[model samples]
Target: MNITKNTTGIESVILTSPDPQAAAAFNEAAFGLGARLQVRAGDAPTSGFRGFTLSLVVPGPSTVDSFFESALAAGATTVKPAKKSFWGYGGVLQAPDGTLWKIATSSKKDSGAATRTVDDFVVLLGVEDVKATKQFYIERGLTVAKSFGSKYVEFAAPAESVKLALYGRRAAAKDAGVAPEGTGSHRVVFGGGLGTFTDPDGFEWETLA
Candidate 1:
């Protein structure tokens, strides 16, 4: 397969949920984003975190608070309440279908800063072998921004594109304060310029033709 460098990162993600419509609606409202592709897996058992969490980075505390509140109103359960941290304000939310989300802002309020879209969006995938998966993407032309031994890794994608991260499966679940539930259909469809492929962890990535 010819893996072109995907400058757009992830254009969309197809999630498998017992209630596909509810999952779609929750995501659209919570992320202020939309998916380009949709697929349904009839009545599959949803499990914890599913080895990934979608991240949204905004500008300041207000945006974090607002987005967090909006997520709750949209039927997402609060995994972590928004709080101020050294990095900025952040929080976590779990959609009805067991998809975890982390919303954060690393920048302080700057009155002179022009309003823009969310600062960054990322798809954090948990894998059993970070080194191998990291190498897989590296061979496919993904630049690495930061890496820590074999435990964690981050890829360098465009600012406007969805970034990718890798973490140990158990560690990722712990980070989300959930138990590691091993092996099930993650039901994720990736949309961009890349082709369809399944990672070592059974997470699926599909692309736009």
Candidate 2:
């Protein structure tokens, strides 16, 4: 799979699947994100969301409502309906491949103004030890954006690139209201320019060509 981020920091991940064209169309229509899919030369495993989720942060309550409705119209299953939260307005959905997605808006204003597009995109992973995972990414050349002891950590991605974060596994599961049962192949493929490496939590990441 190939993942690219737009100048707006919105990422479009192109992947090889049983039917690339259809897959791409589905993703684009479903999430309003770019995707390029192709039939694979080898067997493809089923996809699932076990240890991680893709987060899309928008500007306001209306945007979240619109996006959530759009996703549902495009065949996404609702994991949670959008609602007010201590953090902000947000909801969850499950793609056809079982990838979990969270759409949210922060309560805090951006630069004292609201953002109209995706404010940030991140691959949030649940880890056994947030502090150790933060250290691991730090040692691998990733800069830190913020960290709260071992409870959570966010990494600085290249401008307009998809960001990464780590959180306590149990906490993450609790936040998602799901049981933490990640195992086997993660189904989702990650490719950027960071080279191929598996995090301590067994989440695989690959560098872009």
Candidate 3:
């Protein structure tokens, strides 16, 4: 049986943070993303959800500068002064909601990745109810896998060549060497339409087709 699943290409990563501005700033400098937009409550162009907003992208420095300038005018605050970092290019800004944002160009180490080619990335979701989670994926026409006595399940979509694994929140926390705060503490990679999922404990697996 075809066990591997796939999903539509992930366009970007949405990070949930208490201080999105700081998080965004750190990400830009550390990961090399340019600001895309900074939406705020009431004046926000989207529905639901409130608070500060910021986005980063991977592009040329010039483009990022112009984009960030507009974001600052819209509502974002300047965190660290935007300037060249020791690691090539980097800058920091704050979202109107008090989230910190950072942007920068990819350093050689960041861009010099040696990852294998793949069709798409996968998500490892932490769930309180494993059975219900499995059923949810099943109803969605996804494939599932399990090990004897293992409180974990794997779901894959063949069409998108993407996979999602659900595990007991506690078990996942143990595996990730984290406290399992019931929130996302692991890393979900999204780039080049291919990446892997890394748990808090640093477990990694390729999600390639």
Candidate 4:
């Protein structure tokens, strides 16, 4: 899965779970996502479903409705109703790729946010031609932030940001600044006021604020 973000921050994650509804319920009860969007994923050999979407509780009411409408017009569905409740506004949507999503609103403002909430991160794969990758993101409506040589690049996405790093099987192994005894996929995690994780391929991701 390639997660790309630019400024907005990652509102949610869409994955293939054995039980989408149950997974949504578990997440909602655990993290307070208010609702779930329904998208059917074939068990197997069913040629797979068309698309998928999963929503996460966000901080405001801003353009959520409009966002949903646009998403829907671009091929989305309302598997569940959106309503106001103790949590906030809750809704569910089906993404164009048969992904299920649950979206909710949070009213509490962070007392310490000098800017916005310093939370969440998305990991994106990078190509050896990082300049081209960065340009690609810019053309795709994402904001390019940092490019660290042909070895890595980073982009900003709505609600979340993305980190892209070039991974040449042999070159990266040598660039690790370590003895290349054993290597496959590696993981790096950073935690503090914000938390982040790097995939085996050196892409960094975080969930915070």
Residues 1-209 of candidate 2 have per-residue lDDT tens digits of 11323222113333445555555565667665533121222234643337777788888877777777777877788888888888988888876556678889885333344334777777788889888887887666676777778788877666556778788888877667677765565555566655678878776666555
Top lDDT model:
1
Decoy 2 TM-score against native: 0.80
Question: Can you tell me which runs of candidate 4 are displaced by over 4 Å?
Answer: 1-12, 29-118, 126-131, 158-209
lDDT per residue for candidate 3 within 1-209, as digits (tens), equals: 22443353333435444455665555443334332212111222222111112224334455446546655765666655545546554455544433334444543234333222222333445556777756654554455644323476765444333345667766644433345553222222332233555333333333434
lDDT of 4: 0.40
Model 4 C-alpha lDDT per residue in residues 46-160, reported as the tens digit of each score? 2222211223444554334544554465556676666665766656665443444455565433333222221322333323455665565455345555556565555554433
- Provide the clashing-pair count of each candidate structure: 0, 6, 24, 33
Better of 1 and 2 by TM-score: 1
Looking at model 2, the pairs that clash are 20-37, 20-38, 192-207, 192-208, 193-208, 195-207
TM-score of each predicted structure versus truth:
0.84, 0.80, 0.38, 0.32
Residue 20's lDDT within candidate 1 is: 77
Ranking by lDDT: 1, 2, 3, 4
**lDDT of prediction 1:** 0.73
Best by TM-score: 1
Model 1 segments more than 4 A misplaced: 1-8, 36-42, 108-116
Q: What's the lDDT for all of these models? A: 0.73, 0.67, 0.43, 0.40
Superposition-based RMSD of candidate 4 using all C-alpha atoms, in angstroms: 15.9
* lDDT (10s digit) by residue, model 1, range 1-209: 12233354666666776777777777777666644335456565545557888888888777777788778899889888878777777888887777788888886564444333577778888898999998987766676777888998887776456788899988888767678885556757666655677777877777676
